[model samples]
Target: MIISVRVQQILLLLTLLVIGISREIIQLELWALPLALLSGLVLQGIGDSKRRRKWNIASVTISCLSLCLLLRTQNPYVLFYAIFFTVLSKFLIVYKGQHFFNPTNFGIVVCLTVFPNLSWVSPGQWGNYFFPSLALSVIGVLVARNAQRLLTAFSFLSFYSLMLLTRYLYLGDPLSIFTHQLKSFSLVIFCFFMITDPRTTPRSFKGQILYTFLIALTGYLLQFHFYIREGLFYALFFICLLNPLINKLFPAKEYQWAKKI
Candidate 1:
């Protein structure tokens, strides 16, 4: 059976949602994915068209493999559904697939609210998971993948570090926030997964940098105030909220929104 591009996306999304819910990593109970899937069905009627090979391959390669290999997850079911819900939400939310919010992060939020007990694991402790991100960057380049990936990642991470450093100084905590920042699973995952979401993040170099820094700053505040482990997820969502209206004081062409034909 042939699948259309859009249809494939919807299926992939619901599949990942199921995986997340099933893993008990988020708040949703048994029917979490089904709920999201049902919503997609009602809101965006399922379409039938032949799936594009390259797009499917890319989605499967990154989203699927990342779920399985790169992330330091104990859940076996994370990779069960052969789909990517994060990107699927992107298609639904934005026009022409240009987004400033990471779909994966958004999904994490949904999972968090729906299933608070469900955890999004950290991988900074894992050595193997660390360096593969470098590989993904190269692969992203080889496939002509998201261009502003590093810019977005560095901006978010660096600023997030600064926020922590500030808070640690204010709190008089003797522990090194720098090492803590490096060891955080949230930081690792955001740099690799959420910050790199092509649709939600800006395409231009300067824009991505600004967008990333915004996430880091907000995440720091949330963690300091509320102590949310998945503060990065909420931070990314806030940044996405900001990106639509964000205007740079200093103008650069790379920071401009993607041109949609």
Candidate 2:
């Protein structure tokens, strides 16, 4: 039986939440999750009302969960602002009837940039455990497949992995060093959840492939050359600026959640 893409995303993220909490992998406050949900839902409701559209609870929940999972902050106000801007960006940042910035990504980058002392991202929270990484990959593939953006996810992973491998080869590093980098759960989640976001990604398959390739290349340069830890997020933000042009060049039918799979 096929499931809604949003539903699959929620389930996968919830599973990660449980694992992260139970294993004490993530350093999140107990109140963070509820605050994220409440703020996102309330803000999303207001946005929907303004547009005369029904509220999308699933989408809001997914964004809240993503924020809670990736973003870390001790201040409640910082957390609230993150969720506030995350939901607000959906309504404010639009181009050709679609929002290009992934809401969660936007919020994280905004908070990190604006509140550098209070906010940060912990990419190593998920660790490099083989079994957990595999589980995340399997479920992430299912979610991406349901969203009809599996190719986007895989292409990003492939391109990013190739860059890592090339760098290791150029440095005369061991193959294990390259494989060790590939074991990151944060990278997997970025590939499947953030970059493969249907609304933000290009409609055409070719466009998506090209889009992800650029993201991979930009992220590699930022991480390796500039030494930015959150290079993927920055790369996606920069690449999204060119999304409209990519869509124009490789136009296709826009995706709708209500469309039959």
Candidate 3:
């Protein structure tokens, strides 16, 4: 039987989570995962109830998994608050009919900003495990293919790589520095999963290319110029504010989880 894209996403994220746990990449309290998951589901359920819409367990699962992976916090209450706001943001932060900021990114950013001491984003937490990086890349390609957002993913990575290379040449950085930066596990995940998020991206192919390119350029500036640690996330967050105008200029079709591009 053919699997739904939502199911595919759920499976892929779950697989990544398991691998992360096994490799000790995800070091959190035993209760963190369950608490975060429960919070996401319950909040989402309430949101759906108020909106008189059907509950989507897949969305809840995906958001929670993303939180568990990206966010590192010792406080269960902090995780719960983040997940709670994550679900709540979906309902409150609307543009037309869809949410503008990506749910996972928004939640993580908010918590990080508000509770800087208690919460953190472990960009290098995955380390440079070659095998896991390869596996994640393959899975990301598969997911992007099915989602029809492969172009966006490739565009983002290509532009981002070019920026990195340009910086390396200008700074006269060593080849090893370039290699190390390119092999970042967090960068791979961001390219494949977050940037390729169909719902948040522009509809037309040209729009997506331009959009991803802007994100890459801005991210490069933030990272290299200002020395921001979470440059990619912040770049995406700020750029997403202009998505409405981008969609208006290059409108094609809104993405649907049930439909393959």
Candidate 4:
């Protein structure tokens, strides 16, 4: 039996959530996950009803899981806002029938910018665990491969890693510095899930490669030069603005998800 890519994604995220919660790594309230998931589903249902379309539970759930995993906040209202805008963006922000911004990325960035005091993303929340990182990479690769967005994920990781290595070498730091950075599970999630979102990424292979490069360069600058911890999220958010131009320049067949078996 074959599992749909979206189903695979949901399972993978659920596993990560369980691992994080079990290990006491994810610092979230007991009610936060349910609230995010429920809010996302209900908002998506409302959008579908308004548009006279079917509810996309998979996509909405994925976005909500992303929020629950990455975002940390003391206030429930902030979480609601993040999920609200996350789902709202999918309906309001469209370009030629496609949403350029990754929904979860948009939500995270928005909250970080708008409610910096109340909301934050802990990049180190997952810690530098070897086994979990390896598992994430292996499973993420499979999911990206099935979704046909492996190129986007691989290119982003490669480019981002190169940037880290270059910066470390410039500073005369040991190679371990670079290797340690690669252990960030948050970065892995961003690469495999957020950046590789098929509906949001460039349609053409060339466009996707170029897009990843830009994200890497911008993220590096933001993290190193500007001293921003949440640089990658902002990097993706801003670079997504150029996606329409990227698609226009490197026109190719638009990606369509495989029908559920």
Candidate 5:
């Protein structure tokens, strides 16, 4: 039962991604989705062979779907390149056998930076549908809890909220403005799903808390100080470079999906 936790998460995310298409939550064309999926799967399969490892279709599927959700590309070639690089990053970039940056995030960041006009992120595309937002939050919390990374998720959110509050008071922003920002769909998806990725995050409880706080701080600064809309993704991308150092300073057992089951 415990081992099925990740499988559950994949299924849930896949369902949501598909539903997002039908419900117009994700405004991507039909062809782009298939192209991205094929690109991710094919690249991962070839990469796995080079390393002489068996394929993990589940992980590849999740990565592909996640990229589709976050990256908005009108060109099929652009989508393919985004997913192709995302899959390749896992094999090409490594530290002590673990990929530092989240694969989906790495791909999204690269596309947005390299092809600003071609590929973009619509952070507010998910919109503020009350019931769907509540449902996603609840399921995300459950998945994070099952994965035993709830501490990271909670800490990031708590620190992020506190920072937002402080900024509101300092700027004399309207209470309504503060309330609206807190209800952001992007923040919900990021805190619960993206940042809580057990593989890329710290192994120790203390380390996880510290890592999440710093990510929150960096994201806050980027968003407010620099006015970078993709601040949260960039924060995680740069902070991931410190994963090895964090593991060395606060050593803990590496998390394994199979063992958890």
Candidate 6:
């Protein structure tokens, strides 16, 4: 419904990821509608009305759909509410010419307060929680993730894990902490899905790398030692404040890389 080529391309790829992760296809479908709607709204609002935005619509649609599937939950309304709040936050609260929080991060925070007991899955909760994360590994990291932003995502993941690993060793129980890190499937998913949001991150490659590292480092510091539950959301929220300056700070190289479909 959004566009044609890009939407189809991303849909096929995302569907492949979902099928790879689940035995029951219908369970994943429950999350599709609301997510698609939310992404559609975002893309459509910013997109042109006359001609189609081939890859952009497809990218956003796949991203939202993949997030829903990777989330492995049934509350479409929660995701929708999160999307609504995120968009509202972006336009509503500008501080020194920048919005205070990434819309998605704010939405997730809102969800935590509103639906703590809800079956929301976070990929960061590892250890005994490890098994549930494999799906995310395949979809969130491998497929749904934007390749450009992944380096930053992985940098944060690796650095954050290292901090946790350090804490475990410091506390004299390295194995225990390592095990707990394994169950953090949602954290992994969150990194690829939420942290790497194009609208939030810096535009240049180097800046994006730096941006990713900071977000990851912050998330790690809060999660491992300070025990801040809202690290991911906080990390992304603050990082987004710097997104605008990316183009001004770093020159965007237009290599003949993106093949026109």
Candidate 2 ranges with C-alpha deviation above 4 Å: 258-261
Query: Roughly what TM-score does model 4 have, to 2 decimal places?
Result: 0.96
Q: Work out how many backbone clashes candidate 5 has.
A: 1
Looking at model 4, the pairs that clash are none
lDDT of 3: 0.84
TM-score for all predictions? 0.58, 0.96, 0.95, 0.96, 0.93, 0.61
Q: Which ten residues in a row have the lowest lDDT in candidate 3?
A: 141-150
Q: Decide which is better by lDDT, 1 or 3.
A: 3
Q: Give the whole-model CA lDDT for all candidates, comma-separated.
A: 0.50, 0.88, 0.84, 0.88, 0.83, 0.57
lDDT of 6 by residue, 1-261 (tens): 434434543665465455545634325554556565665566445543322434344444544555454343456666666555655565566654445455556666666667777635444323245555666565555443355656667766777777777777778885966777656655665766666555455657787777777777777767656877666666666666666665458756432214221
When 4 and 5 are scored with TM-score, the better candidate is: 4
Residues 77-165 of candidate 3: C-alpha lDDT, one tens digit per residue:
88998898778768898899888777788888889888999999888888876676777788888766554578887888899989999
Model 3: per-residue Cα lDDT at residue 137 = 86
- State the displacement of the C-alpha of residue 245, model 2, in Å, after optimal TM-score superposition: 1.2
lDDT of 6 at 156: 68
Q: Residue by residue across 24-91, what tens digits does model 2's lDDT show?
A: 87778988988999989999999999999999999999999999989999999999999998987899
* lDDT score at residue 99, model 1, on the 0-100 scale: 46
Better of 4 and 6 by lDDT: 4
In model 4, the number of clashes is 0
lDDT tens digits, residues 1-261, model 5?
454666877887778788878878798787977887777778888988888899878888888888888889888888887887788778888998888788888888888888999988888877655566668778887776544567777899899989999999999989987877877877888888788888899888878878998899999999999999899999998888788888888999998765441
Runs of candidate 5 with Cα error greater than 4 angstroms are 1-3, 129-131, 259-261
Distance from true location, Cα of 73 in model 1, Å: 9.4
